[model samples]
Target chain A: MSFPITLTVNGSAREILLDDPRVTLLDLLRERLDLTGSKKGCDRGQCGACTVLVDGRRVNSCLALAVSLDGAEVVTIEGLASGGELHPVQAAFLAHDGFQCGFCTPGQIMSAVGLLREGHAGDDPERVREGMSGNLCRCGAYQGITEAVLAAQGATARREDAA
Target chain B: MNRFEYVRAGSVAEAVAAGAAPGAAYLAAGTNLLDLMKGGLATPATLVDVTRIPGLSAIESLPDGSTRIGALVRNSDLAHDPGFAARYPAVAEALLAGASAQLRNAATTAGNLMQRTRCPYFYDPASACNKREAGAGCAAIGGATRLHAVLGFSASCIAVHPSDLCVPLAALGAEVEIEGPAGSRTVSLTAFHRLPGDAPERDTVLEPGELIVAVRLPPEAAGFAAHARYLKVRERTSYAFALVSAAAMLRLDGGRIAEARLALGGLALKPWRAEAAERLLAGRAPDAAAFREAAEAALEGARPSGEATAFKIELARRIAVRALERALAGTPERVPALPASPFSAPLANPLPSSGAIAHA
Candidate 1:
């Protein structure tokens, strides 16, 4: 049987008709909503390539069934930039050379943003590495990724302090 | 995945009723359930989404100083909760050490306890796994037994319960509250998970259609919170299943062990509690000799399958001793500041001190 669900994606209301209850949030975003930024690397929860923010918390979109989340506010990688401006995390990734192939970059940036929001992106590099360990980059970009996250976290803290 | 009917349960009664249907399963975080379904290991015809059920996600403090953690409490929330961490550091650390950050954010308390084994044979439909299919035959008996159980394992199945939170929960003596068609009931955390006997498919003792409501920790466990430690040894530094893990809690009276609780994971089908070890440590001075004896007693009846798992018997003994020693040292306010190069350090050399226990 099919299930119907309504979600607020990227600060916009989305009403979708899901014909299958087994459709994952990753498939819904990629196939239905056309938000292809979230990659489907493993299709399992092991790889964090499909990481997204649900109600402002990081979760594996590949394992999240769309039908189960009726009114959740989902923020994919596409939702990060606003008004042609890159998010601090996205900009930091570019500045720190955090990606080689750019496949896991979306999930990495999303997870880093979530980590910063969760107050886990401390100044320590090991803590940042531990906090962002969910998203793996096969290109061996962990050093750059950790540096980018730390930089983004500092920028975020400075912005918050300015306000 | 199979075509299934979905029901978003609004109340506890509705969830139980929907779960009572044939081939129905309760869905919370869907971290394990969805993965199994996608792998064709599980084919539930109906999924009752209980994440929306009210009052099942709260973490409340009881009047007796004990904590009641609802089954729907996410692992990330529980681990990051400062109050819960201060009251139960071992449990919090175990949860943190289990899965990655994204997984912990989506995994629920009951779902972590209910997660199935990560045995490759179980995921392979062509393989003979009694746990996946009853009476199918045991393929993991002699194939890749490194991750298999070393204790309380029957010939039919040797899969270990891959849960880091359950190890500390077993040591804390938590009570699992359940809601079923009949009424609500509570069971000891140690008794909730069952050993793999002839019927390896049955992982838990809960009846069909029963749903976990909350897990309540006893008030006495609060006293041991300050002297608790959880140590997990795995193939990788993080985001890997435990090779051998130990959770230890000690209540000391002027260097004399007043009480002790020890539980081992990744070495048994279920979370293995060291009752014999606890008994040996009680009323004795917390010394290296006493700790060694307790560790030896904990692995008294352990039987490894092959050379691959033979290392675990020795590994578990050393890990248990280290966990107890750390617990006796008492809990630090926060994790010690890491050195500049934490990841570059070798994973094999977990023990830095060149003191006794050279094998570690």
Candidate 2:
């Protein structure tokens, strides 16, 4: 049975007729909304390829049902930047070469943004590593990913201090 | 991920009534349920979405110093709560140890308790699993048993419950509040999960449509705040299931133990509490020799379900010792960077007095 659901994705109001309750938030973002930045790896909750921000929390979108998340605010990789300026996390990824195949980069950046909002990891390399353990890059780009997160966190903190 | 009627429960009473229908299951975060559905392990006709329930998401500190964690409270929320973490550091550590930050952010307390076994045989629909299909025969009985249970394991099923939070909850002697169509009742955390006896399919003691409303930690449970630690041993450096984890909490009177609480995880269908070990530790000095004896008592009835899993018994015993030793050393000012991993060195920073002391 189809359910009428509305969600704010990437800062835009999206009122949709969810024809199938089985459609996950990940699928809704990719298939229906045509926002394919969220990658699907291992459709199960194990892989963090489908990570996104739901109400300011980083969650595995692959496991979240779109119908149940009606009225929730979602932020995906596509929403990370504004006005031709790259998000600090995105810029850091570019600076550090955080991806080889780039399949897991979007999820990693979104998760890193969520992690920065959480503010528990700070700039500690160990905490950053543990915080980002969810998004796995089989390309063995973890060293670069860690450096990017550390750099982005430093940049964000400096911006906050200036503000 | 089958097509099912999605119901947003308006109230607790309405949720109970709607959930009582046949072929209906309560959906909280759907972290585990959706995974099972995709694997064809669980097929429910109706999903009672309980997330929108107003009061179920609260984390209340009762007047009596006991804490009531709403069933919908997310794992990361509970772990990151300064008061909750200060009072129950081991629980916070255990919570942070499980899954990734994303899963913990989305997964709820009740959902974590309701998750099924992680047995590969059970996940494989082709494999005969009594837990999946009653009377289908147990394939895990003779299959890859390295991660199987050692204690409290029945020949009927050898699968173990994969939860790090439940270990500390079991140690704290927490109680689970349940609401059904009839009324409300509470069950101890230890009694909430049933051993896989002849009926391997029934993982929990909850009657159908009886939803877990909240989990309560008694005021006295916070009494062990200074000396509580959860130690987990995993195959990887991080983000891996425990091979054999332990939660150890002690109430010390000077150099001697006044009381003790110990529970082992990833070892049995339920978090295996070690009452005998607790009894042995009381009035004794907290030492390696004492801990060794207590660890031995904890695994007294343990026997490998299969030959391949015999190493788990020794691993459980060793982890038990390390857990007790760490508990005596004292809970860290903050949760370790790597959480329950053995490799995580306890941070030396002094804990903020506000978040370290328990009211109880």
Best-fitting candidate, scored by lDDT: 2
> Model 1, A1-163: lDDT tens per residue?
5566899999999998889888999999999999999999999987799999999999999999999988999999999999899999999999999999999999999999899988854788877888887888999899999999989989988998999
Clashing pairs for model 1 are none
- Model 1 residue B80 CA deviation (Å) reads 1.2
Tell me how much of the true interface, by contacts, candidate 2 captures: 0.86
Report the CAPRI category for model 2: high
Off by over 4 Å in 1: B335-360
DockQ each: 0.73, 0.86
- Over B238-300, each residue of candidate 2 has an lDDT whose tens digit, in order, gives 788888999999999987999999999989999999999999999998777788889899999
lDDT of 2 by residue, A1-163 (tens): 6799999998999999988899999999999899999999989987799999999999999999999999999999999899899999999999999999999999999999999999999989999999999999989899999999999999999999999
Candidate number 2, chain A TM-score? 0.98
In candidate 2, position B118 carries an lDDT of 92
- Per-residue CA lDDT of candidate 1, range B1-360, in tens? 998888899999999999988899999999999999999999998899999999999889999888999999999999889899899988887887878889999999999889999888998998999998889998988898888788898988988989999998998889999999989999998899888889989999888789999999999888788788888888877888888888999988886999999999998778888889999999999877888899899899898865578888888888888788778777767643221111222233233441124422
Q: lDDT of all the models against the reference?
A: 0.87, 0.91
Instruction: List, in order, the clash count of every candidate structure.
Output: 0, 0
